[model samples]
Target: MLSEQKCEACSIDAVALNKGERDTLLLELSDWHIIEREGIPQLEKVYKFKNYKQAWAFSNKVSELAEDEFHHPSILLEWGKVTVTWWSHSIKGLHKNDFICASSCDGFVENE
Candidate 1:
């Protein structure tokens, strides 16, 4: 889990990647969505499955990655969809962590 109070900035430049980048990333990922929320780069992904069991499994996978990165995102789990919002809680804004996690989430989608 990410420490919500720390405001450490990342060295990797953070920019709200455009559609081209998002599209390219999406080719290898299907469960994640790249979005710009409140003028910031955000990953608004919705993982769809037939039932809750699969959603829970994917949520766990995401949690594992979040724990490792120490940059946690907001997650919403439903019966068939899991929405993940990624941003740097530390910086209280966007950061490279968002992109890193977005990329990692993409890989997870591809692998699954």
Candidate 2:
């Protein structure tokens, strides 16, 4: 599945994946949604926690993961929910790395 894949260092010349490509990887992410924000395609998921502390902890874990992969996502940490939006900024669209990261986040929750 996509979770087993790793994020690659994307280049400015990297082209965004086509609809078929995005849909294929997106199938592995059960809770994630395809979105268009400011005309850029992205993958977003909301993770629910028991409390703020748990939510914050998850955010830290995601931060570490992002650092390790050298890819970052837009994260919104709330009282009991954390919204993570993933996209490839360098490519200005969706890339395999984004789905890889999103899958990794889902795997992180499974491990929790």
Candidate 3:
């Protein structure tokens, strides 16, 4: 499972996932969607919470996880929801690490 995997170091020259690979990995992440920003594809998901406190806490957890994995994401924390967009800036597109991190983020709210 993606959550069981660890993110590897992504260099500037690393190749992004092809369309087939991206679609396959995305199948494992039902709640996430592929979106384009500034012409770059990204994996994005909006997690809902009961309150702002819950949303904020979830965002912090994701932040800690990102730091641990050394693969960061663009996290937008708002009232009762947090939108996380993951992409390898080095490659300017989706990477395996993004799917892995997205899977981990899903785990954070499995009980919710």
Instruction: Go through the candidates in order and give the C-alpha RMSD of each one to the true structure.
Output: 6.6, 0.9, 1.1
lDDT of 1 by residue, 6-93 (tens): 2234655554445676565456544556666666656667768789988888888889988876778888999988888987644445
- Residue 26, model 2: lDDT of 82
TM match of model 1 to true structure: 0.65
Q: Judge candidate 1 at residue 107 and give its lDDT.
A: 64
Candidate 3 regions exceeding 4 Å error are: none
Clashing pairs for model 2 are none
Error of 2 at 62 (Å): 0.6
Reference-based lDDT, residue 42, model 2: 93
* TM-score for each candidate, following the candidate numbering: 0.65, 0.95, 0.95
Stretches of model 1 off by over 4 angstroms after superposition: 1-41
lDDT of 3 at 15: 97
Query: Per-residue lDDT for 1-112 in model 3, tens only?
Result: 8978989888767899999999999999968999999999999999888999999999999999999999999999999999999999988999999999999999999946
Model 2: ten consecutive residues of lowest lDDT = 3-12
Task: Assess each prediction's global lDDT (C-alpha) against the native.
Answer: 0.66, 0.89, 0.93
TM-score of 2: 0.95
> What is the lDDT, from 0 to 100, of the residue 8 in candidate 1?
38
The alpha-carbon lDDT assigned to residue 47 of candidate 3 equals 89
